[model samples]
Target: MATVRVGEVEVGRVQVGGGVQIAYARVGHGPPLVLVHGAGLDGRMWQPQLAGLADEFTVVAWDEPGAGRSSDLPAGFGLVDFAHCLGAVIEALRLGPAHVSGLSWGGTVALELYRHRPELVRTLILADTYAGWKGSLPPEEVAARAEGAKRMLAVPREKFDPTLPGLFAGDPPAAFVPLLGTMAHDVRPETMGAQLLMMAEADQRDLLPAITVPTLLLWGEFDARSPLSVAHAFQDAIAHTELVVLPGAGHVSNLETPERFNRAVREFCRAHA
Candidate 1:
């Protein structure tokens, strides 16, 4: 295993499925809490949660396949592929029945993991994510969303400063903005593009009922990406779930308002664990 310091936290790496190296870190020492970042982010995205939760539980943040410091994707890289990769990581690390949390696209993958390998998950946390395209806009709307994503990706890394305001849904702390930039620039654009396409085509509406694990849905009050309606739908559809909206928070509430996010998550895990 290799270690690198991102700010005050020490991150580590491990080789997993497909012989791909997956990055992860462990801190504290209770029930396992596995953290998964969104589409354009790596394991480092959970700095706030890691700092807060690590005092109590085993906080684990890792890079998804084809993103961050992890190895490249194997053939047929899709949501299923990524979810299986998560399962593989759990088995490889022997962290069974772990409390899993994910944001945006990562949330979708977490749900997929519960659906495909329910026995491996102890609890579920979904933030700023959606179930399917049913309530989502039609093809034209999706195309527009894709176009906007393209524009964001098209901006040259040098010109695309992370210090800009409104980088996420709600404005994050000034100290946190640079990290967002680092994550944005560190991401491989092609991998982001492929994952965005995968997200757009994914539909898990039918599979929601299959997830019986206790779930927590965290939504930013003004998340333009997933929207509040998506959170409501997920809460209503899932048999065992609770919805918590972060006031004045945006898409990346965990980063923008770590205290609120961490508190809610910690309470939920303690109550359910």
Candidate 2:
């Protein structure tokens, strides 16, 4: 139960199973809004959301087991493990029935959380995310992505670059580059390898049709990783889903177009709250 303040956000750690300390950043005061960031990134990636949406909602973003200040990713960790860890965070924070939101790989974990612990989620906000590589991408594409991840992990730690092209429509906003670079530089290869493998193997399509809560699918207009077609698939499968595409954004819509992304999330969560 340790906490420290960085500007307005209170960063803290909670012990989950296996004695792993999951770090999280929380701010504001309103309906609980939990953010799950993509692989290779941590809760700090949601700084824009924590700051922008704070006035409207209580925003909490977590560093999953392998990322940020959290403990290492234990061997044999799987998607279900990620979901259960998330469930523990929500429960430990007394944020059950929260507006659960995730981006990219994080979104897949959110779906798994819903599958195992629906009582913890009030609404779903999936941004530029997939059902899973196995579920959303063609077989060949999945294999290629897995191989790419393996290659990335083989790079020397000093030379590893976590930035993926097409994250933004063009260049990422200049103001965000420093923070993005810092996070990229801090990425641990072992953690990344485990997380990417989980992403590669995950398949949550069967759970999509079962999602009963209201879902907001926010996508970047030119998302190369998980394009609009994947968003459409989610919209079709999730019964009560509404899709909102950020006109000029790409894969990382939340960061590439924070204003539009936050606006859509604020509106949707308020309605559901």
Candidate 1 worst ten-residue window by lDDT? 158-167
* Candidate 2 Cα outliers beyond 4 Å, as residue runs: none
Residue-level lDDT of model 1, residues 1-273, one tens digit each, is: 567766656577777656878878666678989998887788888988888998888888889888887887776778887888898878776787999999987888887898789899999999887663333446675676566666766888665432222336645668787887788788776677767777767778888877888999998888877788888888878899989999988888898778999999999999888
* TM-score of model 2 (CA atoms): 0.97
Query: What does candidate 2's lDDT look like per residue over 157-273, in tens digits?
Result: 887877766778898889899999889878888988887877888888899999999999999999999988999999889999999999989998898999999999999997888
Runs of candidate 1 with Cα error greater than 4 angstroms are 1-10, 132-138, 149-167
| lDDT minimum window of 10 residues, candidate 2 | 158-167
Q: For each candidate, what is the lDDT?
A: 0.79, 0.91
- On lDDT, the leading prediction is 2
